[model samples]
Every structure is written in C-alpha cells, then in structure tokens.
Target: MSAAAPYAALSPDVVLAAVDAAGSWSDGRLLALNSYENRVFQVGLEDGGVVVAKFYRPGRWSDAAIAEEHAFAIELAAAELPMVAPLVIDGQTLLRHEGYRYALYPRRGGRAPSLESRDQLEWLGRLLARIHAVGSRERFVARTTLDRATMIQAPMRAALGSDLLPAHLFDAYRHAAGRVDDAVAQRFEAVGPVRQLRLHGDCHPGNVLWTDAGPHFVDLDDARTGPAVQDLWMLAGDEPMMDALLEGYGQFRDFDPGELALIPALRAMRQVHYAGWIAERWHDPAFPAAFPFAAEARWWEQHIADLHEIADDLF
Candidate 1:
C-alpha cells in the first residue's frame, strides 16, 4: 500500500475489531463499500444481519462536526424521512476504537434514482423540499458554509500554490481562474440576496437511492449551510428539468426564482473546487490513481479553457 493512502491502517482486522467493540458480533464477513473520502464496510453479524460501518477520514472533521452530522441524520429520521441515521450504541452514535472514529448504520439498500423520469424527478423534488424544511429548522454551528471564499478563492489559492499544474501552463491557468472568479462574483451580485439554509450540501444523484417506497438519502458527510438551489440545481440538467423539479418543489416549499441564476455560478465554483480537491489530495495514492487526468498537461490546458468558457457564460 502507498504511504499516501492513510486508510492503509484500516485493515480487515481493524474494521471487524471496531464493529466488535461497538457490541456487534462480526461473522468475519466484510465487504468494502465504494467510497474514497472515507473507508466504509458492510459487516455481517452473527444474527445473519448486516450493518454498514463508516470510518471517517482522520483529521477531516472534529468530534463536534461529526456529532452534528449524526444529529442531522437523526433529526431527519425522526421526521420520518428516508435518510439513514447512525445507530446509537451506549447512548452515542459515534464510536471510537483502536484510534479510529466510526459509526454503524442499519443496512438500507436501493438502486440509483432515475432522474430522466418526470415522475421520479418530481418525487425527488418533493422529497428535497421536505428535507429542506427540516434542515431549515436549525443551523450547523460546526460546519462550513458554501461561499466564494470557501469554494472559489480557497480552491484557486490551493491550485496556484500546488505543483499539480504544469509549469508551462501555470500562467494560463491562473489567468483563467481569476477571470472565472470575477465572473462568479458578478453573477452572485446580479442574483442579489438569497436565503441560506442548512442544505444537503452535496445533493448529486449518487447520494440518493430509490426503491418502491421512494428515495432515501445517504451520507451527510458533506452536509453544510447553503442556498436551497444548491441541492436542486445538481439534479436538473436543463430548463425543462428544472421546471419539473420546481413544479414538484412548489408543492412543498416555495422556491425563489432568483436562485436559478446562481446555477451557473455554482457550477463554476464546483469546477474550481473539484480541481483543488483533487490537487490537495494528490499526495494520496487513491487520488492519483483515480484522477489520472489531473496529472496531464493537456488536461490542465483544457481545464483552463473550460474555466474561460464558464466565465464567458456567466458574464
């Protein structure tokens, strides 16, 4: 294992031991879940049941932040939402064992939701509105907010400071990033003030699962405070899609039409932040292997061009 993958220490033994310490009898059956930021697993119990254990990335979140995530899930679950909440053992949802902090959840299974279906999209919209209703009830004191400083400026600084960008293309990349930043700021100003509430933070389709009963939200790891549109825009591919979503969303919560304008700005911010995220994690073996495109000079050139294109669109 590469020294960069800190999860190298999270061997099967450690995983099972953590579950065992949490009062579950591991049947020695373990299946690794698909996750890069955190190490998650499905552990079989002696009673022929399975539970999912998520071992948080070390140093990524403080205990308070993690607790807040747990609290949010629990709150959503209490509202009868289809969100998966961590199981409380010994009066605590978060468990620590062998120098790792983890949480266990009851196994909930569903396939990815079909965003192409109108009914599905509307259903999702209603669900999201309901989630936002619950989310708005409280604010996250420990979590970060989605804003230009955290999303654009910080990412730009990190990218320019990192050696990931090719030396030859550094100036081009910097210039394009600066243009994109200016455009994003102008776009936000034009959109004017919008309501900021507790949001799903990362509400892409992959985070949602669907079954006959409807959709279930998983993974509150990226939960934070942001505009309601932040959760809605990722699901929409075009104007018609947004219409369908908003049509359903109106049934539950009133959405500000002004938020639509922020989509382009949000997209640009995500683009920059994504690159910075990959660069920041380049030291990790998983990142390099998974994002091989980031290592290529041509990719950086294309990325710079894409940034310029987004800037033009925003303006």
Candidate 2:
C-alpha cells in the first residue's frame, strides 16, 4: 500500500482471510458498511449469522489505544446498558492480520431514534447519565480529549498545509480561524475547568440506534474524554430537547446548568472542525470523492463567513 492509498492492499480477499484467521468461518458474502475513517463490513457466517467487522485506520490509533477503547465499551455493556461491545474471541477483541487491526461485533439492527419524542429523549437522558456515572469512574490514558487545541488549532494547521485551501483565502482563513479559536479560548477560560469524563464523544442522534427496547450504540470509534455536555449538546439540539434530556439526566446525576454556557462555543468549534477535518483528510480517496465541496473556493469563502459569524456570536 502506498502513502496515497493506504488501503490499496487491503482487498476483499484479504478481508475474508482476516475473518477466517480469527476463527470465524465466512460464507464469502461481504457487504461493506457506511464508514469513511475505517473500513467496516458485514460478513456472512457459515452458521447463517452475520458479524460486523471493523478494520482500523492504519497509523490513526495505537494498538494500546484501540484496546483501551474496546475495554471502555465492554465496561459500558457490562453495566447492562444497551451498548454493543466488541465480541471477544479467544480472549481477544482486537485482532491483527496482514498489518491491519480489526475487531468483530454481533450484527445489530436498529433504526435512528426520534429526537423529537420527549419520551425517547428522556429515556436517552437517563441512560446517558448512567453512562456518565460509569465514565467518571476512571479516565482514558490513551484516548483523545475534546479541547480547542486538538479540535481547532491542530486542524487549522492541517488545513493550512493542504493546497486545496485557496491561495486567496489563505490569509482570510487564518484570520477567521484565529478569531474563532480566540473566542473559543476566552469562553473556555470563562467557563473555567469543566469536569471531563469519558464520553461517547460523537453522541449525535444519527449514532443512536433505536429498537423496541430502547437506545443502543454500535460504534465507540469516536469515544474520547470530554465534558459531559459534549455528549449532550449534539443530541439535545434545542432547549426543549435539552430540558427533556436533563430532566431524565438529573434523575441519576446532577446537571450543571453552568455548562449550558459552553454550547455556542462548542457548536462553533465543531463547525471549524468539519472544514478542517476535510482539509486534513483530502488526501484520502474517500474524502475527495465524498466531500467535493472543499475543492471550491466559494465553499471556503462561505466557511470563513460562517466562522466570522460564529466568532461574533461568541463575543
């Protein structure tokens, strides 16, 4: 595999062989799942059951870090929450084959839960509070932390390096991004140090899968250390949703109303993060093919405008 196409050597034949190497016999039917950072697939088993196989992005995470993530999920599942942890085989959840790291999970099917439903929101809040209760028990020694530096500064550096960023917008982008970061920094300073815990870092509604039982999570690929609010803000897009979630969340753990102040800052950070992440990963074939907007200077101009708007709102 070349640096440009890291997964060029990871062909379908190798995927099937990886499964077999891990002691699971496949029926030779491999259906790719919707994932960009990592290659995930649904492989049919000899027993007619299917398992989800996730191949980690090379060089993105260390083996120890991945193992730590796996352990966190397994811990959450053990709490009887609706979290889907990796299936352990021969005392190993992380497996290696042909220089690629992978893991297996029981195939779970569920639809996206309705964030509009108060009842569903309340249920999710209760469970999320419980998740926080567990997450606060320990800390991640190897995972990422949600902060302006990693979320904003590092990404800005990556974007600066990408040639896709229009030369005309170079200074504009820098000025706009620096303003946003400064605003975010001031807000963080005002908020002081928040009590951060292990979080389902990307707890947006789409990541939530709902069944007749309730909410269950399948991917912890984005799990990291962050303020509890980071997990809540995405799922609770508005005040009413926040109320319903906090209503249930307060049932198990106390809600810090002060954390509410950080919402706008977080929103702006995420906006910058999306643009910067695209710029950083544009070299990946999937990114260029999937996000064609970044190639346009007009898009960058609009992004800078949005950043300016966000900065104005923050101050």
Candidate 3:
C-alpha cells in the first residue's frame, strides 16, 4: 500500500515503529482508515488499547500550519465541544519518525450521520454554533483562510499545470473556471465584509461521526478561517434541512442570512478546487485509483461545460 515518494517510505513496519516510538506499543494490528490527503491508521496497542495515527502528507502542510491545527482542535475539545483532539505524546502532538511527521488520536468510532433526520440536523447545528463561538475567540496565524485566492485561484493554477487537462480543452477549462472565479468574486463583493472565524473547513457529512451518545467531529486537517456558512451549508442537503439546522443553530448564535448568498459561490469554488486537487495530486496512486475519471478527456469536457453552466446559473 505504498504510494509515491514520501508516502512510499511509510510502510507497515514504519507505521508500527512510529507508534512504538510514540510510547504506544503496537500489537502489530493496524487498520487503514478512510483518508486521502494523508495516511491514517487504527493501530492496536499492547495495553489492549487502540488509537488512530495520521501521517501528514509530506510538503502539504508546514509545521507551523499543522501546529495551529492541533492547537485549534485542543482548544475546541477543551471548550467541551465534541471534538477529536490529537493526543499529546511526550509533550508533543506532532512527532517525527523516519523523516515523516505524524500524530496520534484516541480512536473514536461512529456511523455516518443521517442528514435526513431532523433531530440529527438540529443536533449538528447546535454543536456547530458552539464550535463557531469558540472559533471566533481567536484566529489561526498559520492555517489557511477560505478565500478566493486559496480555494479558487491556487487550484486553478495547479490544475492547469497538470498534464491531465486536454490541450484542446485547456482554454475551455480555463475560461469556464475563470467565469466561476469572477462570479464568486462578485458574490463576495455583494455580501460585503464577513466575520471570518475558525471553522471545520470541510464539514460535509463524511467528516462527522455519529453515535447514540451524540456526534463528534473528526479530521480537523482541513480546518481554516472562513464564513460560518462554509461549515453550515455542507451539512444541509436542502432548504428544509437548512431550516431545521438554523432552528437549532439559533439556540446558540445568530445566523447571518446574507452569508446564504455565498453558498452557490462556495459550491462553484469547491467544484473547481476538487478537480484542481486531484490534478495536483494525481501523482499519488491512491488519487488516480479513487478518481479514475479525472484522467478521461470526456470528464474534463463535461467538467468544463458544468463550470460554464454553473457560471450561467450564477448570473
């Protein structure tokens, strides 16, 4: 299960060795967790305990940025929010082994949240408002901010630089994405200044783990500073669901109706960002295997058309 270069060096032996180094003696049992941007594993320990280890993707995040992420998680958990904060091993959350940086988190299990459940939606919303409340208390000095430049412009450059984009479709792709960028810019302009707060930048259902006790959030790796809507919109499937969420959200904090306008723009930016991410990381075998269609010219063609259609809809 070795990937290219840096990740390729992260073998099972290396994983166990790293865990042992973290003072958690591995019992030689490991299960791969659902992760892409980084390598995550559930390793059993001699004490009959189990923990999840996340190996940071080389060069993806700087040490300072990652430290900020860990600090934020610790802050949220300390606030009594249902957050999975990394365990501090040897007085350090970030550890190095075999030239790779990684972290250990207490293994917490749960099933995917039923987004259709009104109770669940309300519950999620309440917790989210609290998370935002804590988030507003401070900001990340090194982590990313969900703005057009980072989410849209940077991804565009990454995708364009990749060889996967068909030469014939290059202009079409660029033009369509450009339109999305432009529309999103205008949308932000109309919305005026927004209160940027620390957010679980990628708060879709997949990132949420649910159990009878309640819901706890995982994977703060994508955490960033952004409008509160960036965290809310992804959790709601439609208008009714959003209403239900806001119903609970109102219990804790005010929800800005104006940020609602940024939803469409965020959608477009995510669409562009997703493709760009795959393009940039195509060198990783897991990405190509997971997103085979990215290699197909027809997909790019359709992606270009979809981008244009999204732009048209924006107007």
Candidate 4:
C-alpha cells in the first residue's frame, strides 16, 4: 500500500505487493483486526498459515524502537521464553511502507481470559518471572522501571499546571497525598525490602493470550528491566487475586516491602496518565470504550483520602 493509502485498505494485492517488495511475503489474504494507536491486520496465506501485520504510529517512537522490539523478541526467543518471534524483512527489522512501520508474527491460536480470573492472574505472575529472567545487556532500549517522582509527580504537576485537570482538585488533595509521597520515598530508601527484576512494562490483560500450551505474552513494546512487581502493580486489590498471583509465580526471594508499597501510588499514577491521554485524544473517532478512565480518576481522588490505609500493606 502506498503511504497515502488509508492503512485499513490492506487487500491481498496490497499485502503481497508490500511483502514482495522485500521479496518475502506471498499468497496472503490480509484481514482487518486491529484498531488502536497502531494499525494491525491478520494475513492468512494460501499455505494455511497466518500472521499478524502491524503498522506503528510515529511519535515518541522512532523506527529504531520498532527494530529494537524485533531484536528483543529474538533475544527472548533465544532464551526459550514463550513469546511470538518477529520476522525481519528486507534490511529492516520491521517493514516500512507508506511512512509507517510494519511487521508480521505467526498467529497463535488462543482464547482471551478474563482479567479477574485467579488462575490466569497467578499464571501471569509466573510468566512475568520467566520473561524477566531473559538476560540482556544489549542496551537495545531504555529500561522500564519505577521512578515514582518522574513517572508520577513531575508529569502530574505539569498536567495540573496546564489547566487541563482541575487545579482545585489537586490542591485539595495535595497535602493528604503528601503522605503517599513520603511513604513511597521511605520504601525506596529502604530498597532492601523489594523484589527487583525485569518486567513486561505493560502486562495488562490484553497483552496476555490463553493457549493450550499456556499463556503466551504478546506485544513487547514496553518490555524492560525493572521490578517483577511492576507486572502486577496494576492488578492490585482483593486478597484472593493477590494470593493467586504470588502463588502461581512458584518461587520467592527477598522482596522489598518498599517496592510493593508503591502499588497504590502506581495505580493512581497510571489512571492519571491514561485518563489524561484519553482526554487529549477525545476527538479521535477510534478511541475504545474499554477504559472507563473517568471513573478511575474519581477512584484516585477517593483513594487519596485514605492513602495512608495502604501504608503497611505490601500485597
């Protein structure tokens, strides 16, 4: 497809033409399946095989980020971790056509599991443990980790200062919320208490697929070295859920209580970031209804009222 063509119009001919440009793709029927920040299509070839074609949006990410993801996938596969191995066509790790980055992965057959499933949640914890163990020092990409002040306060202050969010709300909550900040800092200072490891930076429900073999992780876009708990921080609340996650991981080492204590803080930060992004893109016609982020914003406000409640709980 030409760079000018709407990414949705990836016909068999278009798919072949683009693939053939690299002298790699053939006889594939491209199907529409993805609708998010990136363009994705599923290609079913005449040979009875299928692959996912992705077209990335350009912004904070450069073409090199796409290539790094390809390299990381290879490294992860080499470590025998369960994941989708990416194909590199032409001299590019990802196909660049029409000014967008693209790549294909063999389709894995699986069902989407409910995010609330204890079994799946536990399995997810273990899966993250295994992925983090995949050693890397290639400096392929910037690592993902918990940097509370930068990831939370600085951007939040900017957002509030921009007059995009209600300044009064921040002012009303700031003093009470200061306790969360102090707690977070204290935990970080006593770093001996948290379990640190590599992480799948964005291991939400969608990134995980349930297959007969087990759970296969997809989309290593945010993969990075950081605390293993980063994978589960967003999945907090509820005792059974927390227990299941830790139990499924099947092993324990010294965990920093400080790192785990940051869960509530991280939760609030994620909701703020997500809601702000969605509000910024509210004019886009394709935004999904899956995230009720406005509700989350309200929840954070309420949680801030009792931030001290989480001061001692690490689970």
lDDT per residue (tens digit) for residues 154-197 in model 1: 88888888899888888998899999999999999998989888
Error of 4 at 15 (Å): 6.2
Write out the backbone clash pairs for model 4.
Answer: 3-98, 193-255, 193-256, 193-257, 194-256, 195-256
TM-score of 4: 0.71
Flag clash pairs in model 2.
none
State the C-alpha lDDT per candidate.
Answer: 0.91, 0.90, 0.92, 0.60
Model 2, which residues run further than 4 Å from truth?
none
Q: Residue 170 CA error for candidate 3 (Å)? A: 0.9
lDDT of 3: 0.92
Instruction: Report lDDT (Cα) of residue 117, candidate 2.
Output: 96
> How close is every model to the real structure, measured as TM-score?
0.96, 0.98, 0.98, 0.71
| Candidate 3 residue pairs that clash | none
Residue 217 error, candidate 3, Å: 0.4
Query: Which one wins by TM-score: 1 or 2?
Result: 2
- Candidate 4 lDDT for residue 121: 78
Residues 126-219, candidate 4: write the lDDT tens digits.
Answer: 7655666563244545444556664555544544454334455666445544555565666556555454444567777677778877777788
Worst lDDT 10-window in candidate 2: 1-10
List candidate 1 segments past 4 Å from native. 1-3
Candidate 3 residues 128-236, lDDT tens each?
9999999999988899899889999999999899998988888888999999999899889988998899999999998899998999999999999999999999998
